[model samples]
Target: MIAHSVDDPLYYLHNFRQVLLWVEQRYADLLDPHELAFMQAFAGLDAPAQALMVRMVMRKGELFRSDRLEYTEIGDTCSALQSLEALGWVREPEQLSLEQLFALLRKDELASGFAGLLSRPRAAKSDLLSQLQALAPAPRPLSEWFAQAPVRIVQWCLQPLCDRMRLLFFGNLYQDWSEFVLADLGLLRFEQVPFSPGSRALQQRSEVDLALALHQCAERLEQGERPGSIVQALAGWHSDNPWLARRHGRLLFALGQQCERLGEWDLALAVYAQSSHAQARIRQVRVLERSERWQQAHALAVQLAEAPANPLEVQALQRVLPRLVRKLGGPAQPRRRARPAPVIELELPREHAALGVEEAVRQHLAQAGGEVHYVENTLFNSLFGLLCWDAIFAPVPGAFFNPFQAAPQDLHDCDFQARRAAQFDACLGRLDDGTHHQAILDRYAAKQGLQSPFVFWPMLSDALLTQALACLPAAHLKHCFLRLLQDIRNNRAGMPDLIQFWPEQGLYRMVEVKGPGDRLQDNQLRWLEFCAEHGLPVAVCHVRWSEAA
Candidate 1:
């Protein structure tokens, strides 16, 4: 694991280029003549321009806010956009600034719910258009245009056709991409660095240059490319910084995983030894066993079985551990971690297309006025939170970001941790003063104008806030808040659903509604146990439908 510098935009751009170039070749025959012609023209473009096109298409697809493509920052204003327009496969309104662009979008209904932005205010005046025209004489970046306006601008770029194309061709890559981008040193947060020498140098060496190159080697090993090239390049990566080395560990793990998949046992073991990835130890044991190093594999397997650090790793290792133990003539007793006690999961059986169980629960809660909200993961993960750690971060300056995934590469960075703690403290102060309720609601309202599901959930009402505050213990708040502060991606789930708040009595209970046979998922079970431990009011309501006789 090499400790590369943090300002590595090339790392992301490398990936951006690789995916496009690979797709262009892989899907060549599938392209219509016009699409083929388009690719040819795309191929003719210089690397920077090509990367820009891919970035736009990869992010927003064929359709997006025209303003986002305008790059007046570096003589890039609308030139690349015009080239795409020349392809006739791309499109935009006559204007680039959103005042006119959104107006155009709304007039045509090009984007669903985009009209909502037309209705959002600016400085207490009517909608943002008039305010935008007044604030700046010309169209700039959407973020700048709406600098004073209260509306979400980040989601304005969307490509409908390109999105479908991705789902059609690259479905398997989606999870892998998410896994990579959602991690600490992944592409998403690392590319936010502005155009500069430092960014340019690393941007060229993106994940594709590193990880994808290794992937291609593993994939085509039989077809002739030497794994030695990859090993040589990997071994050459050197860094004294432990933080950077940890970041590179992911890259090493990716290579080891590929080697293991390709049946390169010795190479896989060598790669795994240097990696501190969660599954690295178990993976090494597998390779060692495959090589018939029975004694060494047995010793490592015994140590892992006795005390595994990663649950998923243990689950995977357990399947093979018993066999290895028997061969080694070891005792059958495995010192497994104690499992959580069972919580009976209730289910509500379907009633043949009648009112759905969820709707029925909603109606039941509504009977008493402001009793229940069907706030699932979408709401709890988004609206109810004080800080939007999911979309925003305040780590040390010069930290890069991924334009694709909405979070940073490494939330675990010591600098990020310290800054996030301070940010969280500020949010807590607002919460105590009752200011956070409205501030959070305002964030939701601002996002209402955008094209994201995160903004469209049930509104965070004042009554809900008051009732929630009454029932929520400080410890629970601290736990959840700190979890979000630390890692928004993993900690966002596991929340109880259908929180029924009684504003009259300033009380609430988390009601998990289920049909006659539905079961609790691991995350749901975790929530129930947390509630149980915390002494919070929670119930798993089960509904049984009568026969239609």
Candidate 2:
């Protein structure tokens, strides 16, 4: 015989007395103390007796399935029934019933009535046949059960029978499973089952298995179908399967145009955003384009261009390449120049070019590894161009920015006009020192339509110098410097340059104010050389880089 051990609380109750008490409290009516004890004894009598013990217990209720017992053993059930009778507990209540038990409890005189009253009469062989026959022809369909019965009845019957009910409403509905019926039943919603020993144990096991299954599903998705399948999966599940939201979003993106064909535009748009692939973004742009929303499409396209390109996204873009080319003015033809490198003598669009002088100075400086000290509206370009070479060749060791600090008089005059001229003179003056003479000479030659030895260069070459030179004569340089200070004082333009140093890296320095790119007149070059010969490292620092969003 296998060793019997009580693993549960029920196992601890050794006597019929205690088992009967448990059953009484547990159910309406079933085991009596003496019958329970006899069953326990019968359990000890080897394999043959164990089968009898089980039947004795089954006599008390309608048997469904129970822990393993061989009901087929010959005469096993009979022996157990006889044991019950011998104990004077479960009697053959010949025609006796529930009414008799009630009557006796009310009377209290018929103690013997208690034993027999508790036992129900055995069913006749003919009655069993009738019951089986009745059930055979009337097999109930689930549809009728759901439609005819109250919703509450189904909810109560289903109620996630175990913690690991392995079912979701929507997912099941997609497959025409009864989960939809469960969800449709009006009732309180719950994220997890309420606390109960059986429920908790079952839930723990169920959740573990669910997590594993989802992981496997994810792996399968990577190996098999495209994202649409995942979306379809998510769309089917109920609230109980809350994990599908993100997966659904990805699928919506993958399904792409087919979804639009299916009239699932909203779902597609949502997936485009949620998906990991950049293709989704391109799809969004296409959707907007197809709708003829030009501005929105343009903005989205720009955003797409800014992002790092990926193959799928590239494919998406290629699909709409013709449309993009058409919208952006037809494939960007290169413009030919009448003159290769124009000189600074002509005053062409001075105001328009002048407006961007400060930006020009900043860009030149950034490329040259220098900083813009101050930009005014005069001779600043010459100074700026010279410093750009110095910075590119010999950059400073550290970073410092002091564009606004200036002498009181200079600070009072940095208005747009004042700054342009001042900057023009400052640029010319610094370059004349001959330290950057070779580069400056090359640059000046380039301005005179000479090509550089270097193969390629940015298109904005000489833009800073030419604009500044066009803004002035010496008189204007001085006038603008003074006016620049006034503008600074009045808050029209920013503050002026007060720093006096080699814009590159040196201890001794001098004040150098930048001027607008359009003010670099002829005399400004001579004045700049004179300043350069006198040991003042005066120059304008054209910037080439600045903060971006």
Candidate 3:
């Protein structure tokens, strides 16, 4: 891997070349003919051409003006564009639409180009576009639109091909070439997990095509496309790959939610029924209930409650089952109530309102003998991340495919802990033998600044780590870690807002602060119950601001 610096003129080109090399080495078997040809052709290009190609690909839009393609390293833009144009990778478009033209041109340029057509030359760019669009002018090349304009517009034709390469390298469309620059600049750092020979995010070419197709469907849905249309389009596509299957299910789930928002209950039910997402069934039940299909909702709710998917589902079921029973005219079932956390009431000065509720509470609770820090979910998660660093980063197949991942791909999967049971057991074993303290401290020191899913490095300090380790019991840590392993996606959040520690007394208390008119959220309620069950000292601090006399 090549490290990039601000002084390096060709840093982006280096990054693009690294991605190409990585894809060629790992995904050679999966690459199609066009992609393969692109790799070969790109490799054979001259330095200036390669740099110019990368600059366009890394940029925001496909359309580029000749005047704007300026680079000091690549001496002549026109000269560099020759090889690219010859290969048909970049070329002048046959015609540019009104919208495309408006996007490419500045206000001054638009006024100059269409001086005769504009009703008001002094109007804003938006008004100019509206005026021109109302005329319904035919699309034409820049040369025809503005004969006197010096700049020529050319569109990069190879964006889709380049996007496919990027997708293969990053495993998703959200992360792009900027990751390389961020890593190079020391703005972001990722753990180095050794990849096995078979470590690939997508095993088959069909999976790659399916992933891209699914992404397009998601974009269409977001753009207000009908849920039924998207559902119909998704009907024929299916993937045996778990990762792809998960993506498919999530997309369907999102579409289902959108349908619900639009009051299309039947469509919501239809979409949810086809989805394999964990919460899809519950959503289906909710939709059925809303649509007045009480019997069906009751039946499905009963089925799910018999063997819930996870704690979150169980929690949902507990809330919905009683109402569903009443709606169906069934016998009333006893509602199980969560044990309430101890409460602390306080009336503080209104002048401290600027500090925010959590901070104000922390300040009020701070004493000479005790310290209060607004840790929220960071402290426990960080400790677990540090102690279980090896287990989390263990080179499991499919867990890690690329070098830039902050966490394993399967971190939220149901079998995440099951697959690495022995490793996690070893990590958690240190707690039982009283070695966890030293292990956490050592890991914190060594792995500081390296990205981890749980550790918030900026908020965590040596003093806090020392105080926490001294005050927090190992048993409590074990319980929290075990719960986190149960359902990492949901269980890792909803911790109390502040923690009060007394190093001298070797005691600590977690506090959840709620200001006037505020209430506990479901996740926060679950955490408080968990703490109560495990005999952990935690409290709910309700704060009210005093009125001025």
Candidate 4:
């Protein structure tokens, strides 16, 4: 748990110190000489200096005006910054681009700074920036831009080093210093998994570099860099680490997608062929088909059909293969149809339209029978999360690295369940012995609001919990849970929109509501089929709104 508090003036400083200590202890070997030196020098700084540094590091941009750096805790910011400057951690930038200067100065300041240079001084900030940019002035120091200005813009030179420390601490660049504050404030809570000594995400220094490289590549892609160029940059990059390897695959997959969108089918095919992402092969087949390579597409589709990776793959192949065979001049195979679910045709009044189709159906159903809740995917997932909390949070090496993780590092990996097969089996054993009810209820009561990948705390109330546990049969739950374990990432969603529970009769039925002109999605269809196969009560509720009487 986070020990820092908002009441403390130096709470941010304490959080920053905690990160430095954590990375220094766990990732000492991975740290470069510069990082080590920075950590050492940072520790030697006084509290005010440290607090000021933390403030700068946590802020959005590297450049900050000295006046804006004011803090009651860090009295006399300039005096504190002197120590940072001595260490070359923070310094006045040599030059600021037009954009940087524009960002630093407000509209009035910009007007004052370049009085005669501006055509329309009173114009909006954006227009003024455009007008200034048209002049194409060379980058210069802030003193040159605003000679009479009192405040100076100091750039945090050690931002990259600080970012590296943050990456090591969090195992990702996306999560930043705010996680500490959010956790401290109880806005976000993580499960307390006992991390092993060898639980760090990146075991080697090269892996750290690889993670950063992958992040940069992703950023480049997002910035609309050419897909080919980004792919070229990643040409020889590889990682033995499963996590890093997964990141690499995802990057390639994204590049492939971008290539497809740009009408570069050949490049997309090449990228997809090289990518290890689960969806890459199917994409490759699609690209082949699109490029009029029918034979190749057919062959690949056949291979996928024979050994599909997951149910989603199987579902996709069923659609692709028949078309491919037809294109290859083979007899068109009959499309396999999804099993039919019981249907509830609802012509609800327009008066209830504002409540949405699902809610309207839920209300109509409640009038006819028992309680109805618009749970969608939450109810069963929450149940599974509660029942199998122990297995999911097991402190396996490489599973957990930091205390801030909401789920394991490898939660969506293919071998996530395989890695904890024994633990999952034991958790499932409770269902067979009828102990699942007590176990789920106990976990719900004890672990309420604590983070779990599967649990949706806001959706699971006492009434819903008690009703679900009582009404949902143990055998049916075992089947659903097993299916969830089969492919957690895909199977967790696509559940029916609402579940109707009859507490008095110990009965329940799930309803997938579809408004007018809406059809069931592939995932929803898959779930409905699964329910039908296991003899679980589920129905498709198609709603059509009617005029009020």
Candidate 5:
């Protein structure tokens, strides 16, 4: 009945028959031919034992004690049943009568001879098959091994197999080796699926603005376009507005990465500086370190390390700190001694000569107000202003040449001219506010291109909100914020600067509305330094009511 079907039930029945043959081999020496035949049929069986064997053979596969029959029925007759159950098979046995046992014993002393056969060392596969042929009237050893072996092994041993790599791992067989083959094949299959765009976007979005920028830069690469100008523009705008800065920063970082891949060191450093995203920034710095720009990379690493504690900030710092320290420790650095300060007279834009940071910024609301254009000179201008105010000052140390110090002759450098032209084209390609943002995100996802900073401002603002809120806990602050919003929505109160205090330590925090010009002003810098020195938390808030300024 078992042999008639191809299912597991038949498979196990065939397997049990082989175990019976191996058992017979163990008692071969003690058996007279006639005695062997009687015992082989039903050695110790009573009428019940004969009936049970008939039932076992009649069923499809192996059976287990306690599967249907209880311990009381099979009892001692199926002593090996428990072991077989653990080996993934079932069992049933019928009790043998005393007369049957006597008849079986007179026929063959099988178990005694079987013990001798078991004492011999197991033969190798090819040798064992040869030995099986010599042992006549016994079931073939090769067929028995085939029946008892695991299905996977049986298939491989009996069938021819080939692999593309021409890697013959299985030709050298040891126990459990076939399992290794299956595991390797499974892993190879798993790796064949292509990466999805949504998953790539999700994975990259630690800093949304930056991620988007990288996405754009990657798209540009795919399209065979240059990303450096977009990167520099973003870096130029970062400090004045973090939101916009972050998007450009991301783009620059992505571009810098491509530059690094192309062996453009100076370009990569510039890109790293513009990326507002912490992860991209870290990656950029690592590129700097790899290029052996140790001092610059170290300075950047320190700023990243000291960035306010958020998950991304903390993780970025942790990842690079050990490597940064190791690089710093490797060589003695030649310190450039401090130089005498540059005496620079302050010259304001002719339009706002007398206005301070606050007043200059307030002018943006006026009809004649000129928005500040971030130029290479603007950075030096801001630095020069800060120095004059004594809020913070650094002497322009003696150096052979400041790369940032523009020279009339250097303007003739074709590379620089090309860069400027590319930036101009990028700026001119700006999209309308709504259309541009989705375009930027789509381009970023495809790793193809970037949007102009004007069009990218919305994404930047979102990054700022995310970046700022991540610094404060919502539990104590959110409820108060919502209440203020509710009051404003119903026209019950005017929007007010937020100021909160905790009585326990007399700790106070204040938020003040300011324009970008005010935040960048000398007085704001003074106030910020004062607050920092006094260990107070003060937030300078820049509110934008319009999508475009």
Candidate 6:
């Protein structure tokens, strides 16, 4: 489950009980009496009501309008709302006076769509207030206000608990909807996993050749005539006699994909046509259709549908051929042939240059330091690895623990936040007691099934961990975790690019390497400020523009 698509819904929901139990056991001491009662009440609710509470935590304030509660498929929300109110966990907003209602209405402009509701002339505010107040029920006494024990208890039990849970399932708690969808979940675990010699070779071939092609000839490709120099370099090769071998072919496909991304269909078609994969042919049919060569496209579609190279190709053919056949009636043409086309000059996006920046900085920083972890987030990730695991997987159901996934349950009912205070307090205690680092190392090393990204033992030397722990004390580390929980959506990046550690002298300095004219982003500024406040050693080293090229 750890290695599967991080987007898998089951991967997260299945861990519900485990996540709950893990925190309960680990952070038992942090729960005060009221908080304990609130958690017990939470556990006793019907699944839908429990899920409704979990969903409410991601939203601001405990109060939600009846309509704002989402994912209605989970269960009867009205019933859940009733259960919550009966338990004294939620409040029904007061039915107020017309004047009060009108005052609330003015919080936003009467929207264009709703202006009709207030189109007629209205009574004066003073008269309306008097009239509405007389008919309104008398205001409740202070005893009703004092009767909100459930509200008080849940706030203590759920806020920190959910925040911690949000950190586990989503390292960035306040991330907007899109960020959650597009997020690279592996960052919490591994961004740079150990690659095999073959994969490394392929990766090197892909990134370097593409970088070199764009860096060296990109300007000329954009300014020059048709057949960008990069594509022209491979112009002589064909599907049957592809002179561009494996590594070069890898680079070729990457450039074609780049052209396709930049909306250069002609260049993409020209480039992909030289590759042997059926996908290249499948892609070309669309380009042909775009160019109005229906007969040629239909022929190729038929060819592919009859004998698709892979399962993906078969699916692709099925999706395209129905429309393609309608175009086939236009003309009869030679079967099993693709149109010959020329590649055009291609432009690179701004980020294309950044591909080479890491290598450039790495080479420059290679000198002087005894060893550089380029530690960035990895160090912090490893330090908090075990706690983060508890956040997501919640390993409470002892015998049911699967090497693959957490115990499955209704996603909405995953009580992510209840034990938050205790678990985090335990993390701070373990780190201070000098047992935290070893525990992370011991568990990660012993469990072959473990895939948590925070286990930095494999990446860093033990001496480095000793130095990192010394530099990152428990209080400072806790402050950082809380900040991450608050800003994970936007603060994932902006860590200093490199750190040079001199183990021989037991010294290290966090360095932000900027390639000329680059300024620190907002998130980076926050981190730098945090470091400055804590007296941690850090520096900003801007690479001279003269050396940039």
Quick one: best lDDT, which candidate?
3
By TM-score, the better pick of 4 and 5 is 4
- For model 5, residues 395-505, the per-residue Cα lDDT tens digits are 111100111111111121112223234432232233212232333334334322121111222233333223223332332232222222221212112212333334333
The regions of model 5 sitting more than 4 angstroms off are 1-219, 228-249, 330-549
Model 2: how far residue 211 lies from native, Å: 8.9
Model 4: per-residue lDDT, tens digit, 158-272? 8878878887877778877877666665567778887555666688888888889899899899999999999889888877787788778888999999998998999999998
Overall local distance difference test of candidate 2: 0.35
Kindly list the per-residue Cα lDDT of model 6 for residues 380-450, writing each as its tens digit: 65666554555434432221112222221111121222324465566556666877667656655554334
Where's the lowest-lDDT run of ten residues in candidate 4? 179-188
At residue 89, candidate 6 shows an lDDT of 64
List the global CA lDDT of all models.
0.52, 0.35, 0.88, 0.87, 0.35, 0.50
Quote model 1's TM-score. 0.49
- Candidate rank order under lDDT: 3, 4, 1, 6, 2, 5
lDDT of 2 by residue, 274-301 (tens): 5544356777787777666656776777
* Per-prediction TM-score: 0.49, 0.21, 0.89, 0.90, 0.21, 0.33
Identify the candidate with maximal TM-score: 4
Question: On TM-score, who's better, 4 or 6?
Answer: 4
The TM-score ranking, best first, is 4, 3, 1, 6, 2, 5
| Model 3 TM-score on a 0 to 1 scale | 0.89
Candidate 3 per-residue lDDT over residues 1-549, each given as its tens digit = 655775788888887888898888888998889889998999899999999999999898899888899999988878889999999999999898889888888999899878898889989999999999999989987778888855788999988888888888777777768766776655667788876566666888888898899989988998999888999898888677877877888898999999999999988998898887768888988998888898999899999989887778888889888998898788998989999889999998998888999999998899435989999999999999999999999987667766777898788877789878999999999999999999998998888899999899999998999999999999999999999998898889899999999999999999999999999988888888899899999999999999998
Candidate 5 vs candidate 6: which has greater TM-score?
Answer: 6
